[model samples]
Target: MKTYFALIFSLFIAATAFAQNDTTQKIVEGRKNSPDQEKKPYVILISADGFRYDYAEKYKATHLLALSSSGVSASSMIPSYPSVTFPNHYTLVTGLYPSHTGLVNNSFFDRNLKESYSMGNKTKVADPKWYGGTPLWVLAEQQHLLAASFYWVASEAPIKDTRPTYYYIYNDKISIHNRIEAVVAWLKLPAESRPHFITFYLPQVDHAGHLYGPDAPETEKQVHFVDSAVYELTKAVTTTGLNVNYVFVSDHGMTKIDREHTISKPAAIDTSKFIVSGDDILVQLYAKDRKDIQETYQQLKKEAVDYKVYLKENMPTNLHYGTSDDWHNRIGDILLIPNWPKVFNMYGRKQLNPGTHGFDPYAVMDMHATFYAWGPAFKSHLKIPEFQNVNIYPLITAILGLNYTEKIDGTKQLAQEVLK
Candidate 1:
């Protein structure tokens, strides 16, 4: 009986030791497969323009919701001040605010260029001088990593005297399927030719939102359509058998607007005293001289319009804008941001659509965007609070294992919470 008891005890100890060894092995293997351990990590950043943060809860985006549930998702991503398309998109890749980046608005007058740069002006859009800060693709090239882009804003311009290894100018005519196929083709390139980083921009959702409002059936349909395209793209990438980190984001959200809520300009002030820029939501007024600036400021402040006007010096501290000299030159002498639902109608233009943005980022949730990340780099089943869009730049650089030397506004610590 004693001998049998001893033998049983010995077997129990052996089993415990084996279990300990297995656990240690797993820990080692996990560390080995971690993002930091990978020599060449592939990252795909997709931007679905105007995808609202709440869309994940409102729409039946099965694939996107699955990604959010299985991976790391934020409640929302806050855009920089003057939450508009061009400014926020550039901010995401550059880690700089609109004012610092010099792309303050979709359209602005550059005193240096002596020309008004509008989204419709392809020549100015392609001009490198209009863009400020080094874009991610340029950073990737500096690190000797191959990069590619598909119709992302500023990708057409040669930023920092460098363009992506593979890129196409903005083309709305291209079908979504073709865009997905093109990206997949780039991924299928031989190991030596494949780009280490890639970016894709889908504008259909934003277009639908602008034309048919966020609550419209067309917008919901577009959400599903974009979700389907992303699902297909994921399947294609999986077929390639490459380990890719995927980041899905949007520039800003959309909100309903109507002509009834318009705030007409006061007749006391002359419109010609300053060159007005920006859209109806956020209006920028640039004056020719200090006297014009003071007159415009006083007249705008005295007006009973449903908007708050500020001089460049007294702008909101939270905006983190107007600090750079380039920004000072580009930003307006008098800034006007209308109250929510009350768009500033400088010329009383007919309301073409029921949607717009560029409201106070804190006051209106419609200005917020979506942020979802998944891959070997991110923790699974994680949900984080809303964060600023600027942080995305540092997070991406970290995932790529590239050393970032620029003095960017985003910090890697803000993004490390989602990493495993």
Candidate 2:
């Protein structure tokens, strides 16, 4: 009886030690996979343009909701100032606000370059010379990790002196599902060349939101469709049993700007004198031909009350915008910010709906976007109330275990919750 009791007591002590070690081991593993934990970790960053936080709760988004429930979530992710698509999206990868990033407005003229940058075409879309600073994909390559982009601006920029290990040029014909298919295919590549970093951009939501308000049934349908695509991608990847980190985000929310209160062209200045960048809400006033800058400045200033006007030299300082040599290359000569309940539309565009973005980011309309993270590297059911989309750079850099030198505009790593 004495021997039996001694043996049982010994067994209990051994089991307790193992249990304690098990808990510690999980923590150690968690830390090992944290964003800053590894130098070459697999990661995926998805941009569902115009995705709103409320939509997540209002709609049946099993995949996205699962990601939020199992990982981290925020009520809304605010965008940088001048919350247009390209600028906000660029901010995400570069970790800099639009003002600092030089994408101040959606459509602006490059005085030095003698051209304009718009969302259309390869020349405007893929020009590396126009882009500034280092992006996430370029940084990933520096650290020896393969980075890939399905179709995001500046993705094809020749800044890095070499292309991503795997990349696809922007093609509108490629359906959202096809893009996700390509991403999954890349993930299944041979282990030696499998992409460790990936960024996916979906235009469906943004398109629908632009055509219809966020609450419109068509836009709601688009939200569901993209959510389903996300589900398919997530399901496919997890089935492979490969460890991965994922983040779903948006550059900015959509607001239905009222189409009234437009500023008419001054009769004093020839309407043909300037090449307008945007129609009504935002307009880049540029010289259509050589014109007197002083005279033009005065004409615009005299009529400023009708609009929120800013000369290149006097754009709102709060925006962190400036007309530096590089910026002047992309900054318009003058900017017109229309008042509330009013939107701008250029006279020539064939846009069916008269709605658009390219306005202040602080307004209630443009402030909210989306931010959520999931996978093996995140804390479950965590909520980060305040975070910037720009922080996404550092987060992705950490996930892929790469070194990013740029002082990130938003660099707060979701580190606390990510560790066990």
Candidate 2: tens digits of C-alpha lDDT, residues 231-325 = 88887777666788888998777767654445455443445677667655566677666555557778767866556767777776656564652
Q: Which candidate achieves the best lDDT against the true structure? A: 1
Off by over 4 Å in 2: 1-39, 175-177, 266-275, 287-298, 304-306, 324-328, 348-355, 413-420
What are the RMSD figures for all models against the true structure? 20.1, 18.7
Clashing pairs in 1: none
Candidate 1 lands at a TM-score of 0.89
Predictions in order: lDDT: 0.81, 0.69
Per-residue lDDT value at 238 in model 1: 91
Considering only N, C-alpha and C atoms within 3 Å, which residue pairs clash in candidate 2? 35-398, 38-401, 39-401, 110-329, 279-345, 279-346, 280-344, 280-345, 281-344
Which regions in candidate 1 have their CA more than 4 angstroms from the true location? Answer: 1-38, 323-328
Give the distance in Å from residue 243's predicted Cα in candidate 2 to where it truly belongs.
1.9
| lDDT score, candidate 2, position 67 | 77
Q: In angstroms, what RMSD does candidate 1 have relative to the true structure?
A: 20.1
